[model samples]
Target: MLAYILRRCFYAIFVLYGVATIVFFISRLTGDPVSIMLPPEATVEQVEQLRRALGLDKPLIEQYGIFLANLAQLNLGDSLRYGEPALRLIGERLPATMQLAGTALVLSLLISVPAGIISALKRGTLSESGITVFVLIGQSIPVFWLGIVLIMLFAVHWTIFPTGGIGTWQHLVLPAVALAFNMIALVTRLLRSSLIEQMGSDYVRTARAKGLLPRSVVGKHAVRNSLLPVITVVGLEIGSLLGGSVVTETVFAWPGVGQLLIQAINYRDFPLVQAIIILLAGVFVIVNLIVDVLYAVLDPRIQYK
Candidate 1:
């Protein structure tokens, strides 16, 4: 297990480095940072000075070396537009994003796991059929549209919750629901299938023959065995929810990394943009690492390999 973990850690490091290298070069290759950062009427000497100051005058390799060195020290450089430290800006906005994503993940799990189990248990019933339709609709709907519809109903018409902002619990409802909807559908489907398979297994029948109650047979035995797939889906979805908040945050004006990324892009703020991408990638890597560790706890027989 330890060897497997070490191998995965090594793989994660390489993946991060690869992602960083891609992000670094792609940002540079796509456009002229100096042109975007400078004024239209700038003199030749002024442009040259700016290039030297930002190290654009150096060879690509040297600039990358500087970036890697600074990154090792956690110095993500300054925001092109804000003139602030990239890490500081990310730190300021990270908590709100974490709060939003965390709440949405909890809501998704609470809603999905039970719905899945009940639907599986009642597989052919009218209620179960209805739930299937619900899941289909949830999966089909786009999150941005959902956010808009939610705002129209709850915020504009009902005026119960604020349409946008990060002020209070009321402000969190629409965005969280929007973010959680797709995850809920996906998790429900995954869990439902897993539960059905577990129920049909020979061990489940054996447990029942031993005179265990149906609930205990399903809950204690079937559910745990069924959880491995659900765990994988949930972990991936949670990471995506945290990092893919760009559109939802934009629509709702939520103060998260996604929104920050948008602002950085519009201004061609390369440092901030690069930092945001790296930070998000790091978050994703960390979440998956934790999920990998969880597999050991979920099933002892499952080795890391």
Candidate 2:
């Protein structure tokens, strides 16, 4: 297990490096930051000074080396827009994003698990058909659109919740529901399929023949075995939710990393953009590694070299 974990960690390093390479080049391709930072009528010397200040006059390889060195030392550079450490600016925004994503994940699981079980158990019945329809509609809708509709309905028309901001619990309702809708639909559909397949397996029949209760046969024998795929999907989805909330966060004005990311992009703030990308890539790599470790924990048959 230790060896396997070490291998995974090594792979994660390669993945993060790939991300850094892509982000570094893509950020540079967005045109010169000095041009965007300076006024339209700025002189040549002014642009040269700005380039020197930002180290843009240096060779790309040299700049990349410096960036990597700083990253190794846990220094994410200073934001051009905010004049603060990129890491600190992102840190201030992370809690709101985390709160939003965490709540959405929990809500999705709470909704999907039971619905999936019931739909699978009643495979050919109206319950199953109804669940399929719900899944389709839920997955088809866009999160940003859903968030807007929710805000209009619950906050504008009914006044049940706040329309925006991140100060209190009331602000979380629309965004959380919007984020969870697709996730719940996807998870429930995957779980339903897995459970249905497991229910018909030979071991499930053996359990029933051995006088196991229906609940035990389904929950212990079938559900446990079928959860491996569901776990993988849910883990990836949660990680995605954490890093990909830019749209939802923007729509809701949630004051999270997503909003900050937009600001960085609009202003051509290379330091902030690079830091955000690195942070997102790191988060995704860590989540996937944790999921890999969980596979051995969930099923001892999954052994590591």
Candidate 3:
């Protein structure tokens, strides 16, 4: 297990490097930040000074080398727009994003698991059909549109929650629900299918034949085996929620990393953008690693090399 973890760590490092490289080169294609930061009345020498100050005067390769060196030292550099440390700015915003993502994850699981289990048990019933339709609609609707509709219904029309912003629990509701909509649909459908398949397996049949209670057979014998895939999907979704919060955050005006990322992009803040991308990429990598480790715990048969 230690060796397996070490291997995954090495792979994660490689993936982060690749992501940083791609984002670094692509950000330059948007043109110079100096041009965007400066006014039309600014002279050529001012632009040159700004460029030198930001180290844009250096060769691209050399700049990348410096970036790597700083990254190795856990220094993400200063935000060109805010003039604060990029990583510190990210850190400031990280909790809100995490709160949003974590709330959404919990909401998705709470709705999906029971719905999936019941739908699987009910198969051809009207309740199952209704659940299927609900999942379809949830999956089909765009998150941004859903967020707007939720804001209109709950925040505007009913005034049950705040329209946007982050301060209290009520402020979190609409955004979390909007962000979780698709994930709930996905998990419900996947878990339903997995449970249905597991229910028909020989082991499930054997457990049933042993005169075990139906609930015990389903919950213990069947559910455990069916969880591996669901866990994988859930873990990946949680990671995606961090980055995918962009649209939902924008629609709801939530103060989170996604919102910060949009502002950074608009200002052509290369360091900030790079930091956000790398931070999110690291999150995704770490989540998947956790999921992989969880496989062994969930199923004893899963052995790490």
Q: Using TM-score, give the best candidate's number.
A: 3
TM-score of 3: 0.98
| lDDT per model vs. reference | 0.88, 0.89, 0.93
Q: Over the stretch 1-305, how does candidate 2's per-residue lDDT look in tens digits?
A: 88887888899888887887788878888888777788999999999988898888999899999988987787889998788999899999999999999999999999999999999999789999999999999989988889899999999999999998888889998899999999999999999999999998999999999999999998887888778888899889977787558988998899999889999998888889999988888888787878888888888989877
lDDT tens readout by residue for model 1, 1-305: 78877887789878878888898987776676678778899899989998898777999999899999988888899987788999899999999898889889999999999999999999899979988998999999998999999999999999989989999899898899999999999999889999999999999999999999998998889999899888888778877897658888998999998899999887767789889888877777777877888888988987766
- Clash number for each model: 0, 0, 0
Error of 1 at 63 (Å): 1.3
- Tell me each candidate's RMSD, in Å, in order: 1.6, 1.3, 0.9
List candidate 2 stretches off by more than 4 Å: none
Per-residue accuracy of model 3 over 170-252 as CA lDDT, tens digit each: 99999999999999999999999999999999999998889999999998889888899999999889878987798889999
When sorted by TM-score, best at the front, the candidate numbers are 3, 2, 1
- Candidate 3 contains a number of clashing pairs equal to 0
TM-score of each: 0.95, 0.96, 0.98
